[model samples]
Target chain A: MIGTAQKIAIEKTKTSKITSVDFDNLPFGSVFSDHMLVCDYRNGAWEAPKIMPYQPISLDPSAKIFHYGQSVFEGMKAYRDKDHNIWLFRPEDNYKRLNVSSKRMAMPELPKEYFMEGLKTLLQLDRDWIPQSEGSSLYVRPFIFASGRGFHASPADEYKFIIATAPSGAYFSSGKVKVLIEETYSRAANGGVGFAKAGGNYAGQFYPTQLAVEKGYQQVIWTDDNAHEYIEEAGAMNIFVRIKDTLVTGPVSDRILDGITRKSILEIAREEGIPAEVRKLKVNEVVEAAKNGTLKEMFGAGTAAVVSPIAAFGYRGSDYDLPQLEKSYASRFKKRITDIQYNRSEDSFGWRFKV
Target chain B: MIGTAQKIAIEKTKTSKITSVDFDNLPFGSVFSDHMLVCDYRNGAWEAPKIMPYQPISLDPSAKIFHYGQSVFEGMKAYRDKDHNIWLFRPEDNYKRLNVSSKRMAMPELPKEYFMEGLKTLLQLDRDWIPQSEGSSLYVRPFIFASGRGFHASPADEYKFIIATAPSGAYFSSGKVKVLIEETYSRAANGGVGFAKAGGNYAGQFYPTQLAVEKGYQQVIWTDDNAHEYIEEAGAMNIFVRIKDTLVTGPVSDRILDGITRKSILEIAREEGIPAEVRKLKVNEVVEAAKNGTLKEMFGAGTAAVVSPIAAFGYRGSDYDLPQLEKSYASRFKKRITDIQYNRSEDSFGWRFKV
Candidate 1:
C-alpha cells in the first residue's frame, strides 16, 4: 500500500538452514521469487504496507498462522501479452474470494481497494519475472495470515497480508491426467469453509491424495460431506460432468467452492448453445452411467488449469477410462478460457482486467 | 536430540523486534518462549532436527500453505508440578492425531519420536518461560505446513514441523461461562475435517463465533452440518448434556473432534455409574428437557477449559437458563481431570506421561 505502484527494497540474509535450492528451469512451485508484498494490520487499520525483497519473517515461533493454521490465500496469474501488457483474468473475483476466505478463517478481511492496488504494485515491479513462454505466467499468490504472536485458540488481533509471485508453467507436464473418486476422504465439510477458499481445506486433501498418488492417480475427486455418495469437486478445482450433450456440475453450497473459472466456463457453455446444469452429480448414477458409456467426458475447472481433462477415475478398486471426443469441451473450454485470459481473443465476458 | 539430559545451550537468538515485555502478566497466546523446536523433511525423511531460538521463517509469498490452506496443528500443554517436574498428558494421542490431520492435509507424517524428542528439547531449554500460576501451564502448539514455496493444486514436496510454547493463566477469571446454540451456521460437516485438528477447521468458526461474541456469548454450540438441527461440539471443544439421570452427547465421526477431555469424562461417568449415551443430541430435546425440568446441567469439555458449565444457552433466538446444582459435574469432573494433571490425585486412567 505504501507504493502507488508496487515498489520493493531488496534485503539479503543468509540462512544455512537447508541446502541451496536450484533456481534454473524450475518446475511449478519448485523455484522462488526474490521479493514479496507485505502489509500489517494493527490498531484496527492497515499500516506500513510495503514490498521487500523476499526474506524470512521473524515470528515468535508461536505465531497463530503456524499453529492454529489460521491462514487463507488466492491463486491468479499475471500474463505477459505479446505487446508486454500485464493482464489479470477476473482479478476482482480473486480479491472478493480472498475476503470471503478471510472472514471464514477469522482473519482480517482485506479491503478490495488495497488488494487490487497491492496486486498492481507487485505486478508492475515484478514484470521481469513473468515468463513469456506459452502456458507460462507469473503465478500471483496473495495471502493473509493470523500473525498474532501466541499459542491460543482465538481470533488474531493483528495480521499481515503478503503477496508473492512465482513463474509457473503448465499445471501438468503430461497431456492428460488420471484421478480418483474420493470415497473415503473429503476436502471440506458441509457448513464448513468449503465455500471459502481457505488453506486448511487443501491441506486436508494431501494425505488422501498421497494415497491416490500411490494408486497411480493425479488427483482425488471429493464427494459430498454427508454420505460421500454425491460427487463434489476435484482437489482445489470445481468439477464438471459431461453426459452426452449436457454439462453438469455441483451447485455452490456449504460444500463446493464458487470457483472463478467455474463460473466463467458456465457462461461460455451458454454462449456456445450448450446446456449447463449446476446441481448434484451422484456417484452411483455416474458410476452406473460410466459402465453403460453415457459418461462421455470428465474434467476439472479452476484458475490454475482452466480445464484439465480426466483420463480416468479410480473407484472401489476398479478403474474406468473415459470416452474420447474429437471436439471435446475440455480442450474447447480450455482454449476459450485461456484465449480470453491471454488476450488472444476478444474479452466478450469482460473477465480480463489490466494490471 | 543431540543433547544430554543435563541443561545446555541449545540455540540462542533474542528477538529484537519485541523490545520490552512483562512475561508474568501475559495474556493467553500473547507471549512466546525464546527457543522453538524445528524439523524439516527432505529426501523422503525428516532431517535437520534442532531446537533454536525463535526467529523469522522466510518463505516465498506463493507458498502453498497460503493459497490452498495446506496446514494443520495440534494443541497440548506441558504442566509443571510442585516438584518442578514437567509432564505431557496424552501427547502421543496428540502427535498421532497431528499426523492423521497432516496426512489428511497432504503433509508429511512427523515421526512420533521427533514429536516427543522435539518437545523435550524445547521445553528443557525454555523451562524458565513456563509460568507457575494455578491454572497456568506451557501451552505447546505443534503444526506441519506445505513448505513447497509456490502455487499449484498439488501437495508440497517439502515440509517444516515446529513446536512453540506460551505461558498462560486461566481462560476465564470466573470459573463459569455461558454458550449459545448456533442453529444456522454449523462448525463442520459429516465427512469434513471436524474430526481432525486442522487449522482450517478453527478458521471456519470465526465468523459465526464472532457473531456470538458480539451478542455477549462466549462460544457457539455448533450443530450437525446437513440440517443444523442436532447439537455437536463447540468450535474448539466438545459439548456434554445432562438430562435427568441420563447423559447424552453427540457421537464422534468424521464431522466432530474426538476430544481428549470428552472421552475422559465419559470414562469418569461410567466409573461413577452414571448413564452416559454418546448419540445425536437434538436442540429441541434439550429445550424440551429443560422445559420438563429434566435438563439437570450442560457444559463443554476440552483441554482449554477442562469443564466449562453453561449458565445459559441462546437457541432459536430464545435464551434458556438452567438451575444450578450443588454437585455440578463440571466442578467434580474438572477437579477429577485437573487433579491427575497436576499430580495431586491418582492416575487411575494412566493418562499422564512423565518427561
Candidate 2:
C-alpha cells in the first residue's frame, strides 16, 4: 500500500500553451492543460505515479481496451475563487467512486496516494490553466483503461490510469436544454454496469441520443431497460423531477449512478428546509403531473454541469414545455453548489477541498 | 465507395517472427501474425487501406475510445486446406455483422471492399502463420475504435479500423467445461447494446465470470437482465441445449448476438435431418429435463470454438451433471463443422470463401 505522503515525480514541459488559449471562449472539453498524470498497473501492482507533458499514448493494436472495453472513468472539476484560491468539490468521493467502478470492471483498484498526490501535483503545476471566469472551471477527467496486449475476451493483466484536465465554460452553453423521454432505447438494465462510470455505458447512448438530437431535442432522458416505465438518467447525469414543491429523484441502485452532485443537491435541499424525496420516479407519474400542471421543474445533476435545467421535454410525439419561474430550485441549488465550490460562501458541508 | 479491384498498399516486414514460434503448442490470441490491416476514417470518408507490419498504435489520451468505449469488433478464422489453399467460412456474414455493430455504436460503416480486400492482402502476406494442425487455425480479429481527440460524451468524428490475426489452438484446452447458470449478474439487457459486439459488453462480464470461476465453473450461462429465467448465451458464444432428441436454442434478438457459427449449426442440423427448435429455453425447463434424464447435451457455438460441450451446470447451489453419450450431438456437430471448415467435406451451403 502506498502512503499519502509519497512524492509524485513531475517533469515540466519546456513551453506552456496557456498563452494560446482563449479562456473567455472555451468549449466544453476540447482544450487540455499542459501536464497530465499517468500511472501504470503492471505485474499485479501499480507503479510509481508520474506527472508529465500531455501527449498521445502508444499502445499495441491488440490491447484489451480496444477490443473488450475494460475501462472506467470519473468526472470532476476545480474551481478558482475570487482570490484565486483553487477548490475541488468532493475529491475523495470521486476517488472512492472511481475504485468502485474499477472493481466492477474487474480492474485493479488505484491507491489513494497515487490518485490524490498525482492529481494535486498536476493541478498545482498547471494552476494557470484554471479558468477564473464565472461559471468556468477546469474539467478534470480521471480514467483507467486496459493496456495489456491480447485479443482474448477477458480481463487484462496490465492497465493504465490517466488524469487529463480541460479548462472549459458551461457544459450547456444554451440557457436550458430540451430533452426527449426515451421509450425505445434504454441506458441500463437491472443487473448491468449502469451504476459504474464505465466507458461502454456512454458509447451505447450515442446512437439513441443522436436520434433524439435529430428530433430537435438536445438530449434523451433514459428509462429503465426492463419496461421503460421508470425514469433513470438524463444524458450522462442523474435526473431530478420537481412535482409541485417537493424534489423527487430516483434512488441509486445497480442501474443508476450514485452521482456526487446529485447527492450534494439532496443534502443542500435538506439544509435549506426544502422537501426532497429519494425514490423511483416513474415516467407516467411525471407525465401525469405535467398534464395536471403540477410538474414545476426538471433538471440534471453531474460534475460537468452542477445543475442543468430542462426547459421542455418531449414524449410520445408530444412536447411538454416546463414553466419558467423567477426563482426556481434549479437556480437556487446551482448558486449554493457553485458558491461552495468557488469558496465564496461558508463550507458548512466540508465539501470543498483546498489545493 | 471503394470497389473490390482497389489495390491495397502493403509494407512487408523484413524479419518474420515465425521462426521463433513453436506451432505444436500455441496459445489462443497471444501470438500475432507478421502483418496487420489498417485504415482510417476522417473528414466524413475512409482513406485508402494499407497493410503494414504489426506494430503499436498511437492515440491521443483524450480519444473517445479511451473514455467512451466507442468500439466494435468481429472474430473470424482462416483455415488451410490439404492443397494449402486458404478458406474463410461465412466471412461475408462477419463483415455484415461488424457493420451492424458499428451502426448501433454510432460508428462509420466500413466498405465491404476495404474489409475483404485488406483482410485477404494481409492474410496472404502472413500465409505461414495459419496453423494446419487439427483444431488450429489463424484467429482473425477485425475491430474499429474512436480515434478522435475529445472529452465530450458523444460520438466521435474520426475512427480507425484494423485487422489483426493470431495463430492459436483451441479456445477450451480442457475437454469439457462446467458452467454456472447466472442469476444475480446479467450480461445484457433488453433495448440495450447486448446484441452488438460492443467492447463494453465483454468488459462487463469479466467480474461475474471471474466469480463463477472461483465457484469451480469455467464459464457462465447468462440469462436475461429483467429476470434470470431464460438462457441467453454461454460465455461469449451462442448456446444450444439438447433435450431428448430435439435441439433447442434461443432465437436472436436485441439482447442476443446473431452468431455466424450458431446460425450455421441450425442450418447444418436441418440438412442432416436432425430435429432443431429455435425458441426461448427457460432455466426451469432445462432443470426439469435434467432431473428427468431428458437433457442429453449442451454446447456453445462461436467462431473461436466451433462447438464446446458442457459436462455439468450449477444453479442455485445445486449441480446437475449431464449424461455422456457414446454418440453425442456435440461431437457430431463439432466434426461436421470442422470438416467443412478444413475442406474435408462438401460445402453444400456455399459458406466457404476462397482467398
Candidate 3:
C-alpha cells in the first residue's frame, strides 16, 4: 500500500482528443478522458500508482479474470460546478465497497490510501474532461482483474487495478423508462456475490434484459433467485417505491447491492421528515398497489443515473402503467442530489469532497 | 464465418521447453504447451484462425470482459496412447457446447471450421507436450471473451476465441474424496447461466467451496437454489449416485450443465446391461437410502478426472461414510473411460478423434 506521502508519477498524452469529441451528443460511456490511473498487486503488496495515457492493456490468455471471473468494479462521477470547481460525492464509500468486493472475489484488498490517491491524481490531470452541462458528468470507472498467467481455478497471484474516466450525458436518454418484471430469470441467489460490485452480477443480466428490450422495456426488475416473488433490484440500480406519502424499498442483504445513491436518497428522505420504510417488498404487493391506485411513483437509483423514473412495469401477461405525478419523489430527489453534487445547494451532510 | 477450405496460419516457437517439465509432479493446469490457437470475431463474422506461441493478449482497459464478465470457456483433454498417437474424445461435443455457452453469454459464435482447425493445428505443433504416462494428458482449454473497448452494460460487438493447452496429470490425485452437500449457497438457479460454461458460474462457487474445504471436504455437491431439495452437480463435474443395483443422476435442466462425460457414462452403462436412470434425484431420497444401507457409491464425471469416486458425504448435521466394494461401478467406469480415451479399447461409439 502506498501512503499519502508518496507521489503518483504522471505521464501526459502527446495529443488531446477533447476537440474531436462531440460533447453535445455524448454517449453514456463510449468517449474516454485522456489519462488513467493504474496500479498492480504482486509479491504480497500493491505497487506505487501511476497516471498514464489511456490505452490498451495486455494480459495472458490464461488470466484468471478471463477464466474464473475474479473481477470487481465501482462506478462514480466527478461533477463540475458553474464556478469551475470539481467535487466527488462520497468517494470513500466507493473505496470501502471496492475492498468488500475484492474480499468476496478472493482477491487482495486495495488500500484506502492507494485508491484515493490514484483517483485524485488521475482526476486532477484530466479535469478539463468534466462536462459543464447540467445532467452531465465525468463517469469514473475503477476496476480490478486477475492478470496471472495460469488457468488454475484458485485466485490469481497477480492483479491489476485501473481507473478510467469517460465523459457522459444522462445514462438514460429518455427521462421515463419501461421495465419488465423478470419472472423466469434470476440475477443472484442467497450466499452469492450479488451484494458485491462484481462483474459477473452485471454480465448475468444481459440476456434477460435483452429479452425485456425486445418487448419494448428498457430494463428488468430482478427478483430473488429462489421464488422470484420478491423484488431485489432493477438493471444496475436499486429500486424505490412511492406509496401515497411514503418511500418504501427492499432492505439491503447479502443478495442486494448497497448502492451509494440509494443510501443518500433514504437519508435525504428521512432528513426531510418524509415517511420511509426499508423491508422486503413482494412483487405481488407492488402489483396489487399498482392496481389499487396506491403506487404513485417508481424509479431506479445508481451512480450512472441519479434517479430514472419508471413510466410503467410489466408483470405476468399484463403491463401496468404508472401515472405521472405533479411532483414525484424521484423528481424531488434527483434535483436535490444533483444540486448538492454540483455545489449549487448547501452541503449539510459533508458529502462533498473538493478536488 | 470461416469455411473448411480456409487454411490456418501456423507460427512455431524457435525453441521448445519440454525438458523443463517434470512428468512425475504435473499440476492440473499450471504448465502450458508451446503454441496456442487464436481467432477473432468482428464485423459480424469470425476471421481466419491462426496458431502462434502461447503468450499474453492485449486488450483495452474498458473491455467488456473485464467489466461485465462476458466470457465463456470449455475443458477437455488430449490423451497419448501407448502407440504414441494422440486422441481427442468427443472434441466435436466440446465445440458444440462452446457455441452454446457463447450464445448464452451474448458473444459471437465461433465457426465450426475455425474451432476445429485451430485446435488441430496447435496440437500438432506441440504434440510432444502430451505426456505418455497413464492418467497424464494435455488439458485443452478453449475460451472466448469480449474484447470491445467500452464500459456499457451490454453485449460486446468484438470477441476473441482462444484455445490453449497445458500438460496435466489426474485432475484429482486422491482416488476417493470427501464431499459436503452445500446447503446455504446455490451454484445456479432456474433461468440462470448454470447450464452454460460461463466464467461467472465457476467464480461464484469459489468462496463457498473454500469454506467447505476448511471443513475437510475436497468438493461440494451443489443443491438447487430454490428448495435445496434436489441435487445438481458436484464441483465442476456432473454427479452420479449408486443405490442398490441402479445408477441414478439428475436430468439436465437450465440450471445444470450437459456434461459430455456424464452423457457418455449413461450410454456406456446401458450398453453394459447396467441399470441407470436420469431424472430428478431428491436430496431426501438419497439420505433415506443412506439410512437404509442401500446407497452404495457416489461419483463425479467430467473430462479432466474422467470419473472421481466419492468416499463420504456430509448433509445437514451428520456425515455418512460409504462402504468400500470389491468391484465398484466407479472403478469399472474409470478404467473403461480411460481405456476409451487412450485408445486402448474398441471404439464402440466412434468417440475418439485422432489428431
Candidate 4:
C-alpha cells in the first residue's frame, strides 16, 4: 500500500469495442480489454497512476527503448471463476519480478502500490472482458520501458509503466509439440541478465527458434552459453523432465528464469508425494535416457501454456519420441493448478487474489 | 540509383527551430534536425518514402519492438565541406548492413533505394543543421522496427523505417580511456546475432558495462562467450593492438560486429604499408606482451569515436598501464581518416559521396 493515498485518474472510452470481438475465437494478445493502467516516472518520483481507454501511445522517434532495448515486462493472467468472480494468480510475484527485471536493465523500480492498485482497478473496470470458458483467461501484461528521447546508450531519465489486458484462449492449440536441442546458439551466459524478463532475452531467441521451427520443431531447448552440455531452459518457458519415477529440472541460476508456473508445478508435485529434483540436467544424459527408454516425459512450464507436453525432441540430426503416460505428473499438476485457478477446489495455498 | 525515378514526398516545417539549438554545447543525441525520412512496410512490400517533420510517433502498447526487441539500427555521419556542400561517407555499406540485421532479427528488409534516396532528401532539407566545426558532424541514425501490436513471440507484419539526424560533438570527450577485460559476462555467442546491429545486443551489455564504469573503467573489452580466452570487441567498438610495428586485431566472426570504422582503419593501415594481421588474440598473449613490453599501443575503433586510444586495462583485479608513445599508430590513423572526412585530403578510395 505504498501509494494508497494517491488518487488514480480514470477516463472511460466513449464506446466499447468488446461487442465486436468474438470471445469464442479470441487470440492470445491481439484483442485488448477496454481500459489500461499507466504511470510515468520523472524528476525522481512516479506520477499518480491512471486508468484510461486502451489506445496507442505517442513516443519520440529517439526514445531509448527503441534504440537500446531498455525495457522489461511481466506476463500473468486473471481467471474467471465459476462464481463469476475475477481472480489473479500470484500477482504479487509478478510485481516483484518486474522490479527484478527493471533493476537488471538499469531502469527504475516502480512502486508496489502503483503496480498492484492500478492493476486491480483496471481489472475491475474490465471485468466483463474476462473469459469464463475453461482454460481461457484474461492475459495481463505489465511492462515498463525507457521513454525519453535521449540516445546516450545509458539508462533513460524518464520511464513509463503500463498494464494492459487481453482476453486470451489457450496459448497453444496443439496438445503436444516437438523441440530442438540447440547447441550452436546459446540463450544466456553467466553474469548476464538472462534471469530478467528483459525484451532482448526474448528477441535473441527468435532467430534460433525460427531455425528450429524450420526443422520441424516448435521450440528450442537452450543450453549454457559457455558449454552446450548442460540444459538451460526452453524458449520463453522452463523445462521439466520425468525419468522413470523422478521429476528433474534445471535449478534456477543467474542464467535461468525463475518462472512462476515452474515453481507452482514443483510445489504441487511435492505436495502430491511425487519426488522432484532441481539440478543441472546434462544434454548427454537426456539423450542417453531417451535412447534407452528411461526418459518418460518432457514438458514446458510458463504462464501462457501452463503445461506443454513435448511429443519428441531432436538432437544431433535424430529425433527421439517421448513416451506418453496415462496418469502423469504434468497432467496432475496442471489439473491441480487449474482447479484452484477456476475456484473448483479449496484454496490451500492461498495463491489466488480477488480483484 | 535503385529508386532514382521514384519521387520522395517532402513536407517542410512551418517554422525552423534552428535558433533555439546550442550547437556549441550540443549533447550527443539530444538535438535533432528539422526533417526525417519515413517509410512503411506491409503486405510483402515497402511503401514510397516520405520526408516529414521530426515528431513523435504513435504506437500500440503491445508493439513487437516494445515487448520482443524486434528492431535494428545503423549509425553513420554526414559531413559539411568547406564549400558548404554536404557529403556522406560509405552510406551504401550501412544500407546493406541494415538489411543484414533485418534478416537476422526476422524483420522486413528495407530497400536500398528507399534508404538512400530518403536520406539524401532529408539531409538536403535539413542542411543547416550540419555542424562544420572540427570533431563535429551530423549523426545519422537509420533504423527499422516492428510496428504491429502482436505478442506471439514472433515477427510483426507491419514495419517502420526511419532516418533522423542529430548534431553531435565527439562521443567520448576524453582522448584516452581505460577499459576492463570482461570475463564473467558475454556480448554475443556462436550462431547468435552479434554481427547484426540489433538493439538487444547493445541492451545486454549495459549492466556489465556499468559495473566496469563503477570500477573506474570507461569501456569493456568483451571476449568469446564459449572460452573467454579469445578477444572479441570493445563495448561498441572493435579493438586493435599495435605490437612492435605489427598491427593485430580479432577477425570478424558471428560474435563480433563488422564495424565500419574497423574496416576503414584496416584498409588505411595496409595502404600505408603498415602490416596488419587479423586473428584470434588470446588473453594470455596480451598479458605476456604487456609484461614483456612488446605491446606498443592499444586503441578502440568505431564510427562514433573514430579512434579512442586506450590508457590502461584491468584484468584479474590488476591494472596495466600502456606506455604512451611519442607518435602512436592510433593518432596517425585518426589524422588520416579525419582529414579525408573533413575534406582536407584526397579521397583515394572513393568513400565520400556528395549530397
TM-scores for every candidate against the unseen true structure:
0.91, 0.99, 0.96, 0.97
lDDT-superior candidate, 3 or 4: 3
DockQ, every prediction: 0.60, 0.89, 0.70, 0.65
The number of the candidate with the highest lDDT is 2
**Ten residues in a row with the worst lDDT in model 1 chain A?**
A10-19
For residues B246-331, could you state the per-residue lDDT of candidate 2 as single tens digits? 99999999989999999999998999999999999999999999999999999999998789999999999999999989998989
Name the regions of candidate 3 deviating beyond 4 angstroms.
none
Candidate 3 structure quality by residue, lDDT tens digits, B1-355:
4555337888887887788999878989989888888888889888887888888899989899999888999998998887788889999999999989888787877778787877777777788899888888899999999888787788888889899999998777787688999989878867778899988888778778888889988888999877789999985899999999899999998889999999999999999999999999999999999999999999999887688889999999689998898999988988888899999999798999998
Off-target runs (Cα >4 Å) in candidate 2 are A1-6, B4-6
Error of 3 at B124 (Å): 2.1
Mind giving the per-residue lDDT tens digits that candidate 1 earns over B115-225? 877788778777777666667877787888766665766777777887877777666556556788887677766555678787777777878888898997888898887
Model 1 C-alpha lDDT per residue in residues A1-355, reported as the tens digit of each score: 4444433343432442113433335466545565677888987888756767766565545566766678877888888889999999999989888887777777777777678877887777667677777787777878788777665577777888888777777777786789999877666666677777777777777678888889999888998766888888886688898987899998887767889889998999999999899888899878887999989889999877768899888899999999878999888999998888788999888998998
The TM-score of predicted model 2 comes to 0.99
TM-score of chain B of each: 0.93, 0.99, 0.98, 0.98
Tell me which of candidates 3 and 4 scores higher on DockQ: 3
Give fnat of each prediction, in order.
0.75, 0.85, 0.65, 0.57
> Order of candidates by DockQ, top first?
2, 3, 4, 1
Better of 1 and 4 by DockQ: 4
Give the clashing residue pairs of candidate 2, or none: none
Judged by DockQ cut-offs, the docking class of candidate 1 is: medium
